[model samples]
Target: MRVLFTTWSSPSHLYPLVPMAWACRAAGHEVRFAGMPSAVPGIVGAGLTATAVGSDEELTGMSASGKLAAWHKQEQWPADWPEHPDRLSPAQVELLAALGRKQCVIAERMVDDLVAVVERWRPDLIVSDVSTFAGAVAGAVAGIPVVAQLWGSPGVLRYENRALGEEPLPEYAALFARFGLDAPVDPAALLDPCPPSMNLGSALPRLPMRFVPYNSAGEVPSWADDPAVRPRVCVTWGVTAAKVLGAAGLEPLRRIVTAVAGLGAEPVVAVTAAQRELLPALPDGTRVVESMPLQLLLPHCDAIVHQGGAGTALTAAAYGVPQLVVPQRPAPMLLADRLAATGAGRTLPHHVVAGDEHADKLVADALDALLTDPAHRDAAVRLAEENAAQPSPAELVPALAALAAR
Candidate 1:
């Protein structure tokens, strides 16, 4: 069988689909990943066949201007938008509509190219990141099955769609009409990697798969082998935050490093090369490593302090490490809340991290709790066990094949 995997241009989005793609390949199926040109490097880096479908210039320009980051700020959104969708004021409804239009615009740019690829390649199945609407369109156009893959979030997009009464925005409806297809072609199945305890209930036909962390591979540092004289804490703000939010994003990193240091724990700052140059001077004893994958770093650490990215939070949970999440956006905030509810982690809102006069003390206090508390560790271990118990990607290959065969 030929399988086409699709996602948007972000590596975080692409990474979640890799394990399943690899599973298909191991089962002797032909696989190709389609995305914007910017995603090619990540697709290739994961050792998958790449099929670049659309231009990256628009996304690149948005990131450079910080417009993309600005859209992600949680403060601009109504606090009750998720729970109280019916009670939304006119302005709040407009805000939600605007966000939907933005997504539709991005989806529109890729649909033509994705549809063309579907016609030429004629894959039996298309596995897509949950946010990649173009994949659903292409699958509908070609009359093939599409499987939606979640990136360890609590199905936020699904929740939002339900809240919106499952109606497509006008922009989305127009995009579908252009191709002579119906709006909102539901996927045949959802491949969820989030553990059952961490997952919010979803009405979709869900297939539980283990999250095998595949943040691009890197060389393990020599220091990683040495025994720690003090408790080692991993501090990271993830790749997207620093690039989109600029200096404002790095400020939390500074506070986290200070907080870890103040508590007499070693701060292992994991960063990209660009982020390394932008960071301010750190206190002595801080170990700064560039381009190191968290999978390699998290196992040895006592705890983690980071931006509440799904990949980071889930990876730490898989390793059974306690977490202190400093979240800037609603998605991450939701992930942090869910993680905290599981008794495995805690959340610190970006407002408090950036605005509190004693932000370092607050962070220190939280990090200190994660380090000293035995309950956090015990809960983390249980979460890890639950994660490990899910069906492996290899086990799910037959189910996917059956869907395509149907």
Candidate 2:
């Protein structure tokens, strides 16, 4: 079987698909990944063949802040924006409009690439990241089945769809039609990649909205398994917050380091290349490493402190580590709440630690609680066991394979 996969080209979006891609190939199926050129390295790193589907120039050139500014000036805006036009602060309005436009641009530019890949490779099935609507259209045009994948549940799951409310699925189909691609039937089948029981008791449609386990394809690094190492604490804000903290929010990192220091735990900080230079001097025991592989690091850690990206939070839960999430975004915060409900973690809001104001005290208290309290640790371990018990890649590969066969 030939399978075509597409995502938004960001690491967070593409990384989850790596496991399935590898599993498909290991089972003797042909798999090809199509997305941003920047994503090729990650796809290849996962040992899958890749067909580049979009240019990085289109994705990286635009800034979220810039687009928001333009939308603020427009007289009329896309009706589906989450906020009321008159009620929003100028900044908020611009931000919403910018995000909508960015999605539209991404969908438009990716269409040509998706169509080109289908014309050349003619894969039997397409698995697209939630943001890559054009890939779904391209798959439809090529007369193949397409499955949608998501990192987190979109908000529409909680709200009923109507003329006024957000309708991401319908919006995607409309965007594809604009690009002259075939409309995907049962577009609901394409929505996936969210974990089970995280959808707040809403019943999912049977066919495509299946709850597949979250996979970051994180591996246990060899150095992490050593018997004599000190108790570990993994600290990260993911790529988005890493940029924000490094550029606009540097003090947050500083506060976190100060709070975690002298706590008798080793701090494993994940920093990107550019952010590496901005590190404040640390105490003797703190370790500043550039992007230590998380799955490798999680087993070694006693607890995790992060900005609550679903990928990291789920990975932490899967490993049964007590999590302390400071939400940098809303969707991930909702997932954190679900994890909290399962006794896997706690959600520490931004306002709780804002402005480096009381962050040191807040983090110190949370970490102290996570480390010393047995209840938190036990809960984390229990959730980890539950998550671990979910169907593995061996099971998922066959299910998707069946989809391709159909």
Candidate 3:
């Protein structure tokens, strides 16, 4: 069977899908990943065929920082910006809508790329990231099945609002209508990478499928296996967060470093080029390294400090590592709170973070509480157990194979 895995341009969005795509190929199925051409290297690195969809330069030029700055200047927020009455005012909503409308111009081009791929490859099934609706529309047009991979918060889905404790936005239905699909898609399967233990709520309408855990890209560092060293702690905001938060947001990460330094465990900070630019000279005993896949690092780490991105949070859960989620964004914050509520981690506000805040007094206190606290550690471990029970890509094959056999 041939599978076409479609996704958006972002690394956070594309990385989790890598293992599954690899698994599909390992099973002898011809698997191809379609997205912005910038994603080609990652797809090829994963050993999957790359089907370029849009321009790499064009996608790279779309700046989250620029969009946020414009929105901030206009006192605007995107309508899709999570429901934070304080952050997203009526004026902000207008700004967000205007931005969203402009963004659709890029999306339309993405759709055009999807049409071209379908015209040529004509695969049997399209496992797509919902943000890239072109693949879904193409699947519908070609009469192939498309399974949506919801990488972000549940708010993107109509019913997910209620589950995620958000008020339903009737307007989103119209957004979906524009894509020529029912407002609330009855997913063939809702492969939620977020662990159910996180309590994100099950707003998705019931379908033939269920939520699954994320497979993060990093591997466990070699030192993790040593019984001698105090457990290692992995400190990282998601790739996008470390980049977007600039110096101010990253200041908290530095504080996290100061707080954890003298404590028992070794601290490892994983950052990308964007973060390195703002990274203040690091304190001694704290190691800074380039990006190592999340799956690779999580096992060695005793816990995590991050920006509360869904993928990273779930990745930590899958490893049974308690998390400290400092969400600069409300949507990711709300999701972080849910995980904290489940006892998988604790949530910290980004505003209070300061140099003195690193007083190690407060940061160590929190890390100690999370690590020693049976409730938090237990919850994360339980979720890890659940993830292990889940079938890997090989397990999902029978179902897709059945679809193809038809």
Candidate 4:
């Protein structure tokens, strides 16, 4: 079987699907990754066969300014949902559906190239990251089955076929016709990595896979292997936030670092090389380094403070490390909500921690609660156990094969 794996250009988004792609390859299926030129390197770096499908427009002279927050809206974030889209009012549904289209707009640029790839490669199956709509359309055009997988919360699930008041989102509906195919708003399957305790009930049937942490390749710092006598707290804001917020990310990172340091815990900040200057002067015992493998860092951590990227939060949860999430986007906010409810961590709104006068105190309080409380660690361990029990990506290969055969 030949399988095509598609993702938009974010490493965070692509990382979640890598394990499953590897599983397919390990099972003797030919797996090829297709995406924008920006995404091809990460795919190739992971040792997968990569086919670049579309060119990212350098058309605009802006350094990093295309669709900065497609699905990162604060209001549209699942602020209040009982895991049911039916619970929302018509107005809310319409509004959210619009945001959902914006979330998927990247696919519009890639569909033509993606469809051409499908025509040439003629894969038996196409598996895509949840946000990669072009692959679904291409699969529909190619008459091959497509399965969508999630890295985190179901931001897209809430808007499936939802009306937009007088102006509804005809995204997939119109999108399919544009390619001369009838698009099924839903996919053949939805794969999720969140533990059952953390997962909101999925409206669509879900295939749960254990999230194996995969950071393409990074050297483990010498300090990571050594144990610390004091409590070690890892602070990270993730790459998306740095790109979206630019120099402004410093304020939030300051609060996170300051709060953790105030507790006398040794703070290890993982940042990008460019992000190093943006960091505020650190407290005496804090160490800031660019690009440390999170999987290596998390196990040695007593607790982690992060902006809620699914990869970051899930990795921490998988390691049974208690987390304190300062959410930059709605998805992280949603993830934070689940973690807090599950007793594995705590969540603070970005505003509370970003330049608010009380930000330092508030963050310190949350960190203290996570640190001294045995319940947080116990719950994290429980979630880790649940995460481990989920079928591994390698184990999910037969199921994918069956889906394709069906």
TM-scores of the candidates in the order shown: 0.94, 0.82, 0.80, 0.91
Q: Output the lDDT of residue 101, model 2.
A: 55
lDDT digits (tens) for residues 47-133 of candidate 2:
678767766673544533564334212232222233233554555444554565566577677788778888888888887775566
- lDDT (Cα, 0-100) at 84 in candidate 4: 53
Compared with the true structure, what per-residue lDDT tens digits does model 1 show for residues 1-406? 9999998766788888998999999999999999988888989998999988866666644544433445456653443245546776655465556556656666787889999999999999999988787888899888999998999886545422434657776676677778887666788999999888877665678999998988887888878889999999999988877777676679878878988998999999999998997897788999998989899999899999888889888899889999999887766876888789889998888888888898888898888889999999999999999999999999999999999999
Question: Per-residue CA lDDT of candidate 3, range 78-191, in tens?
Answer: 333343334555544544444444344445666667877887887887887755555656676567777766664534432222322344234433434565666534345555
- Number of the predicted model whose lDDT against the real structure is largest: 1
Q: Please give the CA lDDT of all the candidate structures.
A: 0.83, 0.64, 0.64, 0.78
- Among these predictions, the greatest TM-score belongs to 1
Query: The CA-based lDDT of model 2 is what?
Result: 0.64
**Residue 334 in model 2: lDDT:** 57
Task: Kindly report the root-mean-square deviation of model 2 from the true structure over all alpha carbons.
Answer: 5.3
Sort order, TM-score high to low = 1, 4, 2, 3
lDDT of each residue in 1-406, candidate 4, tens digit only: 9999999765887888899999999999999999788888889888899888766665122223433333343533544363554566655555556545654566777888899999998999999987677877888887788889888663334433454222325775676789666555457888888888777765567898898987667877777778788899999988866665667866688778888888999999988787787777877878987777688778889999998888988899899999998885555777888888999999988877875898889999999988899999999999899899999999988888888998
Better of 2 and 3 by TM-score: 2
Clashing pairs in 1: none
